[model samples]
Target: MLDQLRQIADGLGQTLAPFCEVVVHDLLEPDQAILAIHNSLSGRQVGDPATELGMARIADPDFTQVLANYANQFADGRQAKSTSIGIKDASGRYIAALCLNLDLTLFRGLQSAMNQFMRMDTEGPRESLDPAGGADAIRARIDAFAGRHATTPRALRTDERRALLSELRAAGLLDVRRAMETIAAHLGVSRASVYSYAR
Candidate 1:
């Protein structure tokens, strides 16, 4: 049974290579329960002792069979997402477990990097990258419209929204490149909705 499980662990480890660690624990030998380990992220050896999870399963037959995407950390504090699956014998007693631990360091780093790359500057002086100053013009028109209506562009009423679109169209603001996108972004509506309103 353990041999078959070892084969399964190896196959899964290969498929999830370089990031995931697959461990097969022999619950019957809790003192040294780690029967096999592949991908080796945690630096755990084959004869390593069972974890608290293994002990928990041993103590309770009704313990959860599958625990997925639970937060875990290595000894060095690298973040991990893990899934643990329990195996039971013919009599329904938990016999072993298969655990997959995915190292999230690279993924977390990528997430942080992407966030930094996409973050917009909300402070300092306003700068318009548009050579036509179309964005500035749009903001000015919306501000004037809002100032006249005693409300913000996003807070404009349904009737007021139609009036505003009319005002924008008369000012040729709708003719600017990607004007619908800019207007919809400020007004918190879809481009299709903005085009519909303009019509």
Candidate 2:
């Protein structure tokens, strides 16, 4: 089954040539997981060690069918967009892995061109006085505050809540009608509790 999948990897690599690098890994051997490779963009050859993603699958059985796209770089420092998929066996153990890496240098150039074509001129912008916008802004502020403290809005302590309310009040966000109710809902707390924080 793994060998058949390696053939699929080869076909995929050939179909997406030049920009795409396809690799197949056998997870049974972490040190030499690269069973087959195509395009060879990363300069990694067969018999190479498994990547961090493969090791993660070995460590966690639940780490199956993971599909993530993130920034990657080639040996020559060229930017790439990479996507990896983990394949598991019937026993819930990861048996194989396939990764596709796409070089993005040309796409970056195209993005720059598109941006230049859609350039916008600065206009005198008017301030929004919508109550809903104010509520959203307040919620964003609360989330940001909680994130800075390494916690969620609902998980903020009393003192943290008080400080957050104070900051909202200072920013005039709490002056909007029903802003307190919105904040309370976002924090998963009662309206009375939000009032207490305001005090």
RMSD of each: 9.5, 9.8
List TM-scores for all candidates, in order.
Answer: 0.61, 0.56
Model 2 misplaced regions, further than 4 Å: 117-199
Off by over 4 Å in 1: 121-199
**How much is 183 displaced in model 2, in angstroms?**
47
Judge candidate 1 at residue 9 and give its lDDT. Answer: 98
Cα-based lDDT at residue 79, candidate 2: 98
lDDT of each: 0.92, 0.90
- Kindly list the per-residue Cα lDDT of model 1 for residues 79-130, writing each as its tens digit: 9999999999998899999999999999999999999999987896886677
Local error of candidate 1 at 104, Å?
1.3
Candidate number with greatest lDDT: 1
Q: lDDT tens string, model 2, 1-199?
A: 7889899998999899988999999999989999999999889999999988899998988974867778888989999988888888888888889899998988899999999999866686766666576787888999999999999999999999999999999999998878988999999999999999999
lDDT of 1 at 151: 94
Q: What TM-score should be assigned to candidate 1?
A: 0.61
The model with the greatest TM-score is 1
